[model samples]
Each structure stands twice: as C-alpha cells, then as structure tokens.
Target: MPLWFDSHCHFDFAEFDQNRQSEWQFARRVGVSGLLIPGVTHARNLQLEALCQQYSWSFALGLHPYFLAEHEQMHFEWLDVALESSLACAVGECGLDRVLAVDDAHWQQQLACFSTHIQLAKRHKLPLILHIRGCHDEAAAMLRRARFEYGGVVHAFSGSEQQGKAWLDLGFCLGIGGAMSHPGAQKLRRTIAALPKTAWLLETDAPDMKPAFWRGPANSPAAIPLLAAMLAQLQGAELNELSAQLERNRQSVLPASYLIREEPSIN
Candidate 1:
C-alpha cells in the first residue's frame, strides 16, 4: 500500500470528538499515514495541540477570517501563548479572505495577524499553513511583500491556473482536497489534473468538504485514498507514483518535524 499524507484538516472539531480514535484507525487502514491539522480559533488552537500530542501528528494554529468578528485585539496575547506551547508543524490557517466582506479596519487587523504569523514561521524556520479564499491576488501580493523564507501549502486551493502558477512561483504547494473530488467540480478537477505533481499535495479538510461518495456523512481522513485515486486518474499517473509525489510535495512544503521522514518506495 502507498503511504499518504493529509496536508490539511481539523481533527479537533466536534465531528471527530465522538469517534476520533476510530476515525484515525480507519485512516491508517486506508493508507493515510499522517495528517496536518491547522487551527481555526482560540478554542480550537489548544484543542488541536492536545490532539497532535495524542496522535503524534503535525498541526498549525491561527485565527480564521470567518470568525474575525469574535476576536478581540488582545487575542494576539493568547496567540503568542499558544504558539509558545504548541509543538505545531507550521504557523497558520491564517490569511485574507474577501469572500464575505472586509472593510479597511478589519482588513488591517487581518494583515497584522497574518504578518505576525509570517514572522513566527520565519523565527522558527518552519513552513506556513495558509487559507486564502476569494482573495488570492491580494494574498499573493501580500505574500510577495512578506517574502516568507520558508514556503508552505495553501489549503483547499481552488484558484485559476494563473493564480496557481503565481503561488507556485512563490514556492507554495496547492492543497487539493475532497472539494476536487466532486464530479461537478469540473474546473477544479481539471486544474488539479493539469497541475505538476510538484505543485500539488493531498488533503481531506475532513468534517467540512466531504467527498461525493460521503456527501451526506461527515468527511474523514479515511476518504484520502478515494480522493487520491481520483486525482491519480485525473493526473494520468500510476497510483503509486502519485502517492509518492504527494508525499514528497507535502514534506517539501511542510516542516520536517511534522512526520517521520521516510524514503519513498516507488515499487
């Protein structure tokens, strides 16, 4: 069986609280050797750290834009505390998202938060775990300005070919998840298929973007192989080759401490 990595997810969420261990067991059975869990909020940050400690998997911590309203200015203090204690693999789940709205005031706050995380990643010489939706251009521009020394993966990326290329130019890997497995996601599937193996990493974004087969049910890491098989078919590569490339892509963008580095057996 091919070893696989889930480059992004939220295993600390309530969806996994009930049967988290069982979920992990199924994921291992289905070839998911490891997962990268990115933090979304204050509550989830600590929870994610604990989860990582328990599973010995990798994780990242940051404030998500969707919950921007709930954050206080002083939250940065807590953020610092969390980062200090965290054995996280990276420094985000943080970035701009113009999908809903972002007035100048909130936008500036978001930038400050993002900048802090970028600095943290640099200080630790770790990769970043990002989330940029509907703000690719702005995010890219800002990233250019930030000029992160250690690049990372852009979680659940669904941008244009141009945007994808632009991010690739910056040395970031595009994360492809269950979202790309939907039959109706023609553009995403096509884009992912055409992307160079070096530019792609597999993720599930579990409990959120469930694959088509598990539409009504909660998404789990167990769905990784299902997504990977579809991706390999689309990319026109052998399953083992795709899996190896995916693992390589992940290790290249994420911190080495995230997983046990092992040689890819191409047999």
Candidate 2:
C-alpha cells in the first residue's frame, strides 16, 4: 500500500455518521497515515473536535461561506474560543464562492469572516486551509495583501496555471482531488502534470466531489490511492515516487505532531 495523506476532507459530515470509525479504519488499511478535516461552520466545531479525538486525525475550525445565512455575529466569538482550544489545527473552509448567488452585502460579510480566520490563524500561529471557488483572483488578492506566515492548501483547486503559479508563489499548496480523475478533465489533468511536486497536495473532498469512477454515492478518502495513481500516470512518474513526493508535500503543511506512527515505506 502507498503511504498517503488526505490534506482535506469532511469526515464529520453526516454521510459517515453511521460508520465513521470504520471509515477511518478503511483509510488506515489503505495506507492513509493522516487526514485533515476542515470545519465548515460554527455548529460543527464541537463535532469536529470530537472526531479528531475519536479518529486521531487533525482538524481545522472556521466559518464556511456557503452557510453565511446561518452565521450570526455570535459565531465569531465562538470561533475565538474554538481557535484557542487545543483541538483546532488551522482556520478555514472560508473564502469566496460566486457560484452560490451571494448578494454584495453577504459577499463582503464573507470576506470579513475570511479575514477574521486569517487574523486568528496568525495570532495562534496555525496554518489555514482555504476553500476558494469561482473567485480565485479576489481570493489571491486578499491572500497577497495579508502576507500571512503560516500557509495552507486551496482545496478542490480547478484553476489556470497562471492562477496556480500565483498561489504557489504565495506559499500555498494546490490541492488536487477526484476532479482530475474524469476523462473530461483535460485542462485539470494538464495542470496536475505541470505542477511541481512541491506545490501539490492530495485531497478527497469526500461525499461531495466524487471521482470519475465512483459516480453515484458520495466519495471517500479511501479513493486517494486511485486518484494518486491517476495523477502519477498523468505526470509520467512512478507511483512510489509520486506518493513519496505527495507525502512530503503534505507533511510540510500538516502539523509535525500529527499522524505519528510507522508510515508505510513508499519504495
């Protein structure tokens, strides 16, 4: 089995509510040493903390823009408490999403929320795991202006090489997921091939962005090796070498103390 790290996932989501423990065990059997769970909203902070304790995986806590309707002012205060807590690893799942038809007022509010996450991350010296969609330019601008020290990956990245280059230059890793597994994803496959190993991170975005092969049901982190194999083939690199590179890239961003165990030997 290839040693791997799923840099992003939502194991706390209801999809695995019934058998979340079994899911983690399956991931372990498949050689996934560690997984990072990003908090999608305030309500999930406690749930995610419990998940980290239960599964022994790290987690990030923040407000997701998609749930802005439910995010009240009090949530920020709650966020402060969550960030101060030992269970929190990073701050995010926060960023712009133009596809959701957000009004200008709400959009600005999201930006404010995003900025708050950045500030809290800096204060606590933890990395951030971002969720950027249709608004890469705006997100990049905000990231550039902030000049944050601890950086993180841009989850479910589907962007141009130029955009990717900008993020890479800004100390961010580009997260590749099941999106590139599709035969129709030529552009994304090309980007995956072009990205330097150092600038790449692996993710599943499970139960949401299902890969090409697994269509009907929600995707799971266990599909990492399948996608990693696909990505390796696209880059014309051997599976072991590619997995090693990805593992190193993941560890560079993930907390050092995370996933301490006997990792599978890639070679």
Highest lDDT, which number? 2
Query: Please, what are the lDDT tens digits per residue for candidate 1 over residues 1-267?
Result: 888888887788888788988888777776788898887877777577666878878888777877777766666667666666667777778887766454878778777777877877777777778888888898888778877768888889999888999989988999888888677899997787777888988888888988878854688888888888888988999999998888778767874645534442332
Which sections of candidate 1 miss by over 4 Å? Answer: 81-85, 102-104, 257-267
| Model 2 Cα lDDT, one tens digit per residue, 25-54 | 777778788888888877887578776877
Q: For model 1, state the Cα shift of residue 194 in Å.
A: 2.1
Clash count for each candidate, listed in order shown = 0, 0
Query: RMSD, model 2, all Cα superposed?
Result: 2.9
